[model samples]
Target: MREIRQPGAYSYVYGKYEEPIATVKPGETVAIYTKDAFTDQISKETDRPSQIMSNPNPQTGPIYIEGAEPGDTLVARIIEIEPTRDYAVSALIPNFGGLSNTNITRTLNEPIPEKVWIYKLEDGVLTNNKRLSFPWRPFLGTIGTAPALEAISSITPYDHGGNMDVPDVKPGNTIYLPVRVPGAYFFTGDVHGGQGQGELCGVALEISAKVTIQFDLIKNKSINWPRIESDTEYMVVGSARPMEDAARIAYAELIVWLEELGWDKWEAYQALTQIGELYVGNMVDPNYSLVAKIDKKYALID
Candidate 1:
C-alpha cells in the first residue's frame, strides 16, 4: 500500500495527463488525503465565496497505474473514506445551483444569498442546527481518469469521470473507468460527508478526507463511460445536459454493458425496462449525470 498526502500536488482540471505523484502496480492499494471542493476556503467565520480566488475542487493526484493504458479498463475499489476534519461545509453560491439563476439559466434576478453552513461530524452523524442532522455517509464527489485529448475542468463530469457527485460512489463500490491515456492518470478529490440525489444547492457536505482505494487493470476491456459494481447492483453512469440526455446515455451504456456480458441486446433492453433504476447524480454540474442500474440478481450474466 502507498500513501499520497495532499500538500503541494493538486489539480483543478481533469485532463492534460499531468505527471503522476505516485505509481502503483495493479491490485495495489493507495491511501490518499484529499481536500474538500472549496479547498477549505470557507470557515465558520467566512460568509462569502468571493473571498477565495483560487480554482475550486482541487483534486489529489493523477497517480499512474502500472500496466494501465489507453483502451483498457481501470478498476478502482473504494476501500474506505474517512473524514480528516471534524467539520464540513456547504454553501449557496450566488450564481450556482438548480433553483438559482446560474451561468446557463441566465436569470436577471439577484443571485441567491451566499450563506454557509458548517456541520459537525460526530459519532457518524452530521449535525448543524438541532433540527438538521443525518448519518455521515462519506464519498468522493470527484474521481476519474484523464480524457483522451482535452483538458477538462474539474467541475465538469464527462465520460472520463470528473466531479460526478453521485452518492453511490462510496465505499464498498468499485468504479470502472476507460483508460484514455498512458498509465490512466487517475486522480480524485471533492470528498463529501453526505449529499442528496440532485445536489440541489450545487454543494453537499464538503469535507477533507482520507480515501483508501485499490487499483486494478483489465487488459483489452474497455468501456464508453464509467461503471460501478456494488454489493447489490451494477450501474452505468452517463453525464450530459438536458437531464433526459443523461438518462439516455446511462441506459445506452447499460445496454452495451449487458450485451458485453453475453446477454442479447433486445433481452437486455427488455430487462432494463423492468428492473433498471435511474438515479440522478447531479443536475447542477456542467454536465448533469444519471446512473442506470440493475440488481445483480437480475443481471443474468453467467
Candidate 2:
C-alpha cells in the first residue's frame, strides 16, 4: 500500500492545476496520514481558534490515479480510519456555526466567544473527561477529486466534492466521484473523530487519523455528482448555498441514479418522495451539503 503524508503533501484547494503529490494505480489501496480539522494546531483545551486565525481544511493529496480520465467515475472504498492521537479537540469559533452570526447571516448580536474543548480517548471511546463519552467513529470530512475547470477552496463542496463533512464517509462505504481531468487527482483530509448529522457547531471531535482507502476506476461512467454506497443504502450528495437548494440537488441526483437503474423518471421521483431519507452533512461550510439516500432493499424492488 502507498502512503501519503500530511506535512508537505497537503493542499488547500482542489483544482486540475494543482500538482500531484503521489500516484497510485487502480485497485491499489493507499494509507493517508491526515491532520485534524484545526490543521493539527489545537492540542490542549486552552488552545483556541484564535491561534490559527484562518483554520484552513488542509487536504492530504492530489493522488494521480494511473488510468483515470474524463467521463470516468473514480471509486474510493474506505477500508479503515484509525485515530493517530490520544486526544481530540473542538472549538466554538467566533463567527462560525449554524446558529451563530456568520458572514452571510449578519445580526446585531455579539459573536460567540471562542472556547475550546479537549476530549481524550479512553479505550475506544472519546470523553470530555468530565462526562459525555462516545465511541470513536472516525471518517474523512473532506474527500474529492479535482474539478475540470476552476480552483475551489478546501472549505467548499461541489460536484468535485471537497469538505462535505458527512459522517457516512467512513469505513465499509464506497464513494463514487466524477473524473473530469486526467489521472483524476484525488485529495482527502479533515478527519473527524465523530460528528453529528448537521455538525451544528461547525466543529467536530477533530483528530489526526490514518485512513486507508482502495481506489478503482469505472470506465466511461459519467456522474454529475458524488454517490456513496454502503452495505444497505445508496446515497447521493449535493452542496449549495441555500439548504433547500442543497436538498433539491441531492434528491434530483438520486433520482437520476435510479433512472439509470431502469426506473422511470416520474416513478423514481414518486418512490423517493415516499421512501427517501436525507442526511445533513455540513451547514456552515461555504456551501451546505445534504445527502439523499434510499435503502438498497427498497430501491431494488420491482
Candidate 3:
C-alpha cells in the first residue's frame, strides 16, 4: 500500500492545478496519516484557538488516481480509521458554530465564549476523566475529489465533496465521489474521534488518524454529488445554504439513484416520502450539509 504522510503532503484548497503528492493505480489500497483540524497546534488543553491555530482543516493530499478521468466515478472504500494519537480536542470557537453570532449572521449578541475540552483515549473510549465519555466513533470529516475549474477552500463542502463533516463517513462505508479532473486529485483530513448529528457546536473530538482506503474507478459514470453505501443503507449528501435546500438536493439525488435501481421517478419520490431518513453533517460551514438515506431492503425491493 502506498502511504501519504501529512504536514508535508497536504493542501488547504481543493484545485485541479495543485500538484499531486502521490499516485496509485485503481484497486490499490493506500494508508494516509492526517493531522487534526487544528493541525496539532492545540495539543494541550491550555492552548487557545486564537493564540495557536491559524489555518483550519488541512487536507491530506491531491493524490493522483492513475487513469481517472472527467465524468468517471471515483470509488473510495474506507477500510479502517485509527487514531494515531492518545488524545482529542473539542473546543468552542467564538464567532463560529450554529447558534453563535458569526461573520455571516450578524447580530447584537456577543459571540459564544471560547473554551477548550480535551478527551483522553483510555479503555477504547474518549473520557474527560470525570463524567463525560464517548465511544471511539471515528470518521473522516474532510474527504473529496478536486474540482475541475475551481480552487475551492477545503473549509467548504460542495459538489465535489470537501468538508461535509458527516459522521456516517466511517469505516466499512464506501463513498462514491464525482471525478471532474484527470487523476481525480483526491484529498482527506479532519478526522474526528466522535461527532454528533449536525456537528452542533461546530467541532468534534478532533484527532489525528491513520486511514486505510481502497480506491477504484467506475468508468464514465457521473454523479451530481457524493454518495455512500454501507451494508444496510445507501446515502446521498448535499451541501448548500438554507438547510432545506441541502435536504432537497440530497433527497433529489437519492430519488435519481432509486430510479437507476429500477424504480420510477414518481414512485421513488413517493416511496422516499415514507422510508427515507435524513442525517445532518455540519451546520457551521459556509454551506450546511444534509443526507438522505434509505435501507437496502426497501431500495432493492422487487
Best by TM-score: 3
Residue 239's lDDT within candidate 1 is 97
Cα RMSD, each candidate: 1.2, 1.2, 1.0
lDDT scores in order = 0.90, 0.90, 0.92
Give the per-residue lDDT digits (tens) of candidate 1, residues 197-278. 9899998999999999999999998899999999989899999988999999999899998888899999999999998999
Better of 1 and 3 by TM-score: 3
| Better lDDT candidate (2, 3) | 3
lDDT of 3 at 256: 92
Instruction: Tell me which residue pairs clash in candidate 1.
Output: none
TM-scores of the candidates are 0.97, 0.97, 0.98
Candidate 2 per-residue lDDT over residues 185-261, each given as its tens digit: 99999999898988898998889899999999999999999999999999999999899999999999999999888
Worst 10 residues of 1 by lDDT: 45-54
For residue 297, model 2's alpha carbon misses the true position, in angstroms, by: 0.8
Error of 3 at 267 (Å): 0.5
Clashes of each: 0, 0, 0
